[model samples]
Target: MHNPALDFAVNKENKTITIKREFAAERPLVWDAYTKSELLDQWWAPKPWKARTKSMDFREGGRWLYAMVGPAGEEHWAVADYQTIVKHQQFIGVDAFTDADGNINSAMPRSTWDVAFVDKGPQTLVECLISYDDLAQLETIIQMGFREGITMAMEGLDELLVSIKK
Candidate 1:
């Protein structure tokens, strides 16, 4: 088995972050892991933090509302509004921190995410581009440990793929 590396880059001038990760699974399975709420809840959050979806509608113009629950039982909610979707290939969405009622938190940073899945023989490569409105918003997320959190979450996904492959 090949060990895939995660490529994460921050482009300050563009106010965006790009992440590329290769998974040992095929494109269809990987796409399901990302698009299905049940599958995502299994590996979306870092350890000691659990993801719980309150509601989800995985169509264009629909939204997913979920919370990342801490070990202490605290919850941080967020919503991802899907703008576009192309089965097994790509999807675009706007993500924002939100209240439990699904109201966006204006003070928090919001971003537009473009995620693509590509077939690479036995593996699937996921490319993600996240754009913020400005550099300040990008900086805020970075300072809040976005890099570390996402890296951990991806590692969780790696474990998930391996277990589900059998």
Candidate 2:
């Protein structure tokens, strides 16, 4: 089987980051993996870190509150508020770092994510456009190893998709 590639792009001028990845699964299955909290918790975080959802409401105007638990049991929380959803096609949301109680942390950069899913025969192409408030915020995330972290997470997703197909 051919492994799909992951494309990550940074646009400092636009204050945005774009990531494209292909999954060896159909669009609907890929969409479910993203939307369902159960599936998300399974592969959302990279290895040595686990994603634990505190609460989730997967609908427009709803939000997902989750924490990334490090190997040492330390936790970092985040919340994503869903702005729009179009079934298996696309979804838009605003994501921000937060406390476990779900209070947004103003010190951290917030981003708006517009994610699209496109069907490619037996595979699904997932495109994510993440926009930040300014260049400083964009640079902050990059400096924080966003590329490497996301790459690892997506690789985890790849393994997840294969296992779920069984």
What does candidate 2 score on TM?
A: 0.98
Q: What are the lDDT scores of the predictions, listed in order?
A: 0.94, 0.94
Per-residue accuracy of model 2 over 22-100 as CA lDDT, tens digit each? 9999999899999999999999998879999999999999999999999999999999999999999999999999999
Candidate 1 structure quality by residue, lDDT tens digits, 1-166? 7667889999999999999999999999999999999988988998889899999999999999999999999999999999999999999999999999899999999999999999998899999999999999999999999988988888998899999985
Residue 8, model 2: Cα distance from true site in angstroms: 0.6
Lowest lDDT block of 10, candidate 2: 1-10
List TM-score per model, in order.
Answer: 0.98, 0.98
RMSD of 2: 0.9
**Model 2, global lDDT:** 0.94
lDDT of 2 at 150: 92
Candidate 2: which pairs clash? none
